[model samples]
Target: MSLLLEEISIKNEHSFRSKIDVLPHIEVPWHHHPEFELIYIEKSRGTLVVGDCIDNFNDGDLLFIGPDTPHIMKNEDSYYQKKSDLRAIAWVVHFKEDSFGKEFFLLPEMSRIRKFLTKSFQGVRISGSSKYKIIQHLKTLHSAEYSQRILTLLQILQVLAQSEDLEYLASDNFVETFQQRSNQKLYQIYEYVSKNFQKKIELEEAAKIANLSKTAFCRFFKSKTKKTFSAFLNEMRINYAKKLLVEGRLTVAQIAYECGFNSPSYFNKTFKSTTGKSPLQLKGEK
Candidate 1:
């Protein structure tokens, strides 16, 4: 499926958008934008999808997603029922990398934060003391005026930069797959893989989608994502296999076929190589 491109509106007087969303349910769907997103869940319970990662989220969860990454925080089914009284509340902020200034992040003083921003491309989950500090800043940010808002956001980034209690949300290669969604060719390639990974996908077919010769497409895809097309496809399949393994509903062989692997042995080998754990081992753990 194609992801929607979301347009975020920033006030004329402000360089960034920060607000608290308190609603019976979330209205946004799976969408992406060309801005960095920082969000803290004040109160909620749901599933969060970012790039190739899918996991549960609870109250007090904090997340950071870089530009052009597709994401969604979908509430549980009960929250969508008309008679349900549950509420989803969160503090969200959106800003561009250059929102502060073109040279702001390039300064020597911003080295750590600059590196942190790069890591955000894979999405981040902040926890422990860092989440606590960032949440306080997020609350202040929503109501701060003028310069104070900018300062608070900087403080949030500073905390994120120095903190050790952090976990990356998306797979390493998944971010590269969607980081240039605005490019039509890249979007077509990503969409095609996302939709048809459960079936046989030939390199020639993918080359045709990109309108390039097979050799040119292979080199182009490697240049853009730093991996061979086959490797990328294998990672995609392995990621899905992991999710299915976690759910504990399907047998390993069935999951291998479901994820488009030609054989159970090959699936086991690829799964172990990619994640450092065999499928049955993961299923047993779950």
Candidate 2:
């Protein structure tokens, strides 16, 4: 499926929804919604795509995403195996700005949180002490009563508002582009690239996938994602390479081939150009 606008339901007894989600894999395809989301991955390792950002996520990772931002967390191949008993688990919370009240966040006491939520339009990864603190609050919120849940959520937001451990995910320009025009064709292209980047990906193949002529597809892809198709695919490959480098189980040459590079020299060139660090250097530092 292309980009989906998922409709989330809130019970009458709850102003916002909070629950623990467990699955054999992340079953939600690329999708967006009208609610702000905070997710704490309790157990998982996967590729996380938020708007135009693609990166790796593991257990204990936390993210806050704004409304209408297309995103997904796709598990590794191991999670999809029927014989494997691996499970993905996360504590997820979804709420609208008006969930408390239309004017609740506009109050003077809520100024910091209001600003923080506005910044979340670009999506963010919480790390360091901030992530640990929020995880504690999320655990309580997951099992809390109605009023306690409200208090705990407010506490979570408060910590986020005052913290400096936030890493913004999607670029500002990409967020604007996605919000203005969410194209099913563009989403389809993203899905195809994400799945096939390890193999030889031709522009003609992508054009056929989008059902557009090559010239039109180039223009459309650049207009929608603010990057050439080649650049986007290279980014996806380099991101996976970075994760592998951190794992420290492979040599640079092996990692280059594993991440779909035709040669180690070219992989070194591209890796440095993209990340300003050579693969060996990054691995050593890690």
Candidate 3:
């Protein structure tokens, strides 16, 4: 079945458009648009699927996605306390490449801005002091006049161009898979995995989520996520373990069992490999 999706455009008089969206507690259908997107999430938490990257996102996160990149924001149970609750408040800005004119970004003096936009196509998250500036600018953009709004947009781009902690979210093959949109298969696979990863998930069961044969599912999953099913499960388990470890409420063995690992030794190995620190070390470091 196709998942429910919604898009709302906030009023703007400038060349670019702004929006505030509230995604429902369902998988966002796989889709892409030609406009570049700048999204600032004010509330809620979930996994953000941008191209081939899969990462958890929490409140106050800001991300910039390039034009025509396929993406979805998947909110499983963990994102909300109630099924009917709104999981996120986001400010999205979409602008075409020519909105600012080619010369604006291509000027010899705008080398850094050019690089920033180029890198954003693969998806990126902005953090640190720059985030605060962007947030403040977004507030002003909403209230400013036409000329002032354009100035705010320029300020936002300038901040992004100079930020140092920007993180790339997708892999090298992300561009290829991002361009394809036949069905919402990837969204289904991710939702199933997010909800069921705490238990044993067989290939056959996962395949059923996509309504595909086991063999086809295996190949498709690897191609899109760049990891085998087992590997993805391991990562999900370890992510849970990390959360428990940070909470300081569970012992290592308890966490292992709770996260569905068969043995503490295996959990230790995976956790260390994924986080570069032992469970004890992680707890102590925190």
Top candidate on TM-score is: 2
TM-score, every prediction: 0.74, 0.90, 0.72
Best-first order by lDDT: 2, 1, 3
Q: Model 1, 139-254: lDDT tens per residue?
A: 88878998999999999999999999989978776666666545566666766776578899999999999999999999998887788989988987887788789889999999
Ten-residue segment with the worst summed lDDT in candidate 3?
Answer: 1-10
lDDT of 2 by residue, 83-152 (tens): 9899999999999999999999999999999999988988999999999999999989988996999999
Residue pairs with backbone overlap in model 2: none
Better of 1 and 2 by lDDT: 2
Give each model's clash number: 0, 0, 0
State in Å the error of residue 73, model 1: 4.7
What RMSD, rounded to one decimal, does every model reach?
4.2, 2.1, 4.4
